[model samples]
Target chain A: MNLKIEKVAIDGVLVRMPYNPAFCADEDKTLLHGGVLTALLDSVFGLANFVAIDGISSMATLDLRVDYLRPAKSRADVMVRAECIRQTRHIAFNSGRIWFDEPDQAEVARGAASFALTRGEVSIFDAMTQSRSSK
Target chain B: MTPDLATQQLRKVPFFQFLDFTITELAETHAAATMPFAERLIGNPIMEYYHGGIIASFMEAVAAISVSHGPDLQPPKPINLTVDYLRPAVKGALMAEATVTRKGKRMASVRTACWQDDDSRPVAEGLYHFLLV
Candidate 1:
């Protein structure tokens, strides 16, 4: 998934994912599969956790729950807002919502997740950013 | 529908085509599929692990097929889902099986599991609910 971070801060993040025909459900490419929304939320949640929580070695998703409120029908880009609500010594909690980029901005899905964290001297964020920049 | 026939039908779905899975087993209340690993499916760039969402998505696809297939042209409405990640999936073909737990006039519940090698050591398990109306 080619993701664009439109906005990011300690509180949360706003991401935009363009609609790709490959992820569409029907032959007409009118509606997107719910799985794409799930995948998008999963990715955004990771970003949120990386930004919100300070210092860690690694993180892994423990579980995720998503509710599909409506059919993901639209040709416009999809916007996702995610935040890490709480953090513990070895765990992180996240919540997020998704919508189309249209004016109405109708919500398509809502999701929550928890991640198992390993705290260390080096942060996963720095590692990832370094590897990304190096490449 | 026969597995071969179901595979043909699935090709029409763009997302399924993108996932590039083949229907291996199809029953009245169960469905199974296999998806080969691809570059785009990797979530952890450094570790090269299969994205947790892709595993959930694959299971959801199989679950939907288990719930709605045959004469129904309209797909089942996805209401909600919960997924538990048990292990990281390495770069290899993934298999998923979906079993319909309960089906009512207005709703249906499905359970799904995905694995790369041994079925006992699953990568993930999911519970999905769909609106049948």
Candidate 2:
């Protein structure tokens, strides 16, 4: 199972996927493992900021809301599309969609998220400045 | 919606801090350490594939990450996590990507998706909302 970063479009954004049998979590339903999904979503979003953000920065996902739209039926191929929709001085925003095939579009899910981008080191604010940081 | 201490407290749990616990990284910056796919992590009833519930947990984790990405904002505890199983995840290393769609004083909304072997077809999709306590 070699899952490499496939595409990193404009603005340093990164995209990738896994192609193997271990990516599966369940064998009966042919459904994917939850951890795998988490990995995919996390990678793309992290890459999104890694592309745009400057300096040695860090972010904590305060909230992650997900709504599953439909079931992915394909067994051979799967895809996830993500893009940065907005970026503020303090935070970076992005959105993404998943599809199994074309025409049908057959959307598997849609997501929108926010990540806090900051300069300086992580411990400085987490350790020293308590209320000075801007989110 | 600001989350209560309980929600914020979930981040302190060590069980939530494993590499396989990819979503846990959403609790804080710095990508997850490892991708642990233990046998117990496998899903049931899905047959030959993985279960969507496990995937849902990961989605929930990402949603948590999106809501709590900001340093100024304390990561919101998951008040509601709804997931729609799109398809079976591939049997291998899988990854997910998510970003904030909207953030308010009391609520945060985000989106995420699961990619398997093929970055073209998503194994699952999710829309998440966090209630600020």
Candidate 3:
């Protein structure tokens, strides 16, 4: 199935993935929560992996070291910049940063990640069926 | 599993281990996980929202539990984690949801969101990666 991917440009690299409020508070007028932020960063990192790595494979997060430079300003459109630094046999390393509309100046969060790649069975059915109801 | 087992596993995680954090789930998985906040977590102003580091810990916890739900994700560990702070988390319980994005033998990804119950909006959003290692 085609994932609903969202794209935003930054520093010459094109970052794309599906990122929506999914659950934002109307009163606060802010994004859903910190877990959602983590999910977004994870998505960008995965998209980087999907782009850098080919074929069907299962990967896990070895380390996702993130530093919150600043809390996102209220009611701002946030964008992430992800890059695959290096990919090796059975292991891939990458890093990326996110910012609100202000690309050069403001930063929402920054992180570095590593993934172990291996040939294994993956069920697309399970991926699609897991949380469609919850959404 | 039991709380002790979960604590042991959570401690092994590099990021979790870094913070000296232990798992305190108000409820079981496939539902809701309420993680209590500690004093050490506040990096910024003490009275304001929780420190970003604390928020990251919460995101990581959600991701761990989310991917662990998958049968094949035995000995699941984080590969990547990205966090976005939407707002400040004041003094209170932090709520989160860890959703599995993909699960393969080699690697699996999960998404999680964190928020305070009172505001209804999340303080941060995160994506967690778990490698079979």
Candidate 4:
């Protein structure tokens, strides 16, 4: 997924991913696979968690739920907004929605998830950067 | 339909092709598939763990086949899905089996479980709903 962060606020995050025909379900390449939307939501939720919570380390998705409100039929870019709704020492809850970048912007899917937090010395961001630099 | 025939059908789907899985079993109310670990499927680069979404997608693909599979099959429309992650999917092939819990004229429910090695130790379990209409 070629994702771009469009907005990041304390309450939520917005991301955009261009539509790819490789992710289509039909031979005609008109309709997208529902799993693509689910994957997008999951990724966006992780980003939201990373942005909202000042965590020291990594997190894992405990569960995920996604509802496809409509057939993901469009060549337009996909947009997703996600937020960490609540967070405790060991857990975080997230909610989000997906839509097209076109006008009317009908919601294609809605998702919610919970993550198991692992707070430690190094944040995932730092760890990732350090790993890349070391590599 | 035979598993080989089902796999041939899956090749037509771009998303399924991306997943690169094989239909290992097929029956009236059951479907199973196996997906080998690939770098593209990794969610945590440091740990090289399978992405949660990829696991869910693989399971959903098998679940869909369980509900409908044949030539000129009008694939069921997905309404919703819920996935529970039980364990970390490491760098290895993952297997998923889908069982159709209920099938009606207009709807169907499929339960899917995914595992890496031991069948008893599932990495994830999911429930999916589809609209036949």
User: Top lDDT: which candidate number?
Assistant: 4
| CA-lDDT, candidates in order | 0.92, 0.52, 0.56, 0.93
- Candidate 4 per-residue C-alpha lDDT over A1-135 given as tens digits, one digit per residue, 9 for 90 to 100: 989999998799999999899999998887999999988888889889888888549888999999999999998999999999999999999999999999999999999999999998778767776887898
TM-score computed on alpha carbons, candidate 1: 0.96
CA-based DockQ, model 3: 0.08
Residue A42 accuracy (lDDT) in model 3: 52
State candidate 2's TM-score.
Answer: 0.44
Q: How many clashing pairs per prediction, in order?
A: 0, 90, 43, 0
lDDT tens digits, residues A16-77, model 3?
A: 33333332312243543343445456556656775666652555455556655554434555
Q: Candidate 3 docking category?
A: incorrect
For B5-124, candidate 1 gives per-residue lDDT tens digits of 888998999999989999999999999999999998988867889988999899999999999888555789899999999999999999999999999999999999999889999999
Q: Chain A TM-scores, one per candidate?
A: 0.94, 0.67, 0.67, 0.93
Model 4 error, position A56 (Å): 3.6
Query: Which of 2 and 4 is the better model by lDDT?
Result: 4
lDDT at residue B112 of model 1 (Cα atoms): 96
- lDDT tens string, model 2, A1-135? 233555776454434454444554323335543344444554466566655565525543323344456434345455666676777777777676666535666766565566666576553223323432432
Which scores higher on TM-score, 1 or 3? 1
Pairs of residues at least 3 apart in sequence or in different chains that clash in candidate 1: none
**Every candidate's CA RMSD:** 1.3, 17.3, 17.3, 1.2
Q: Rank by TM-score, descending?
A: 4, 1, 2, 3
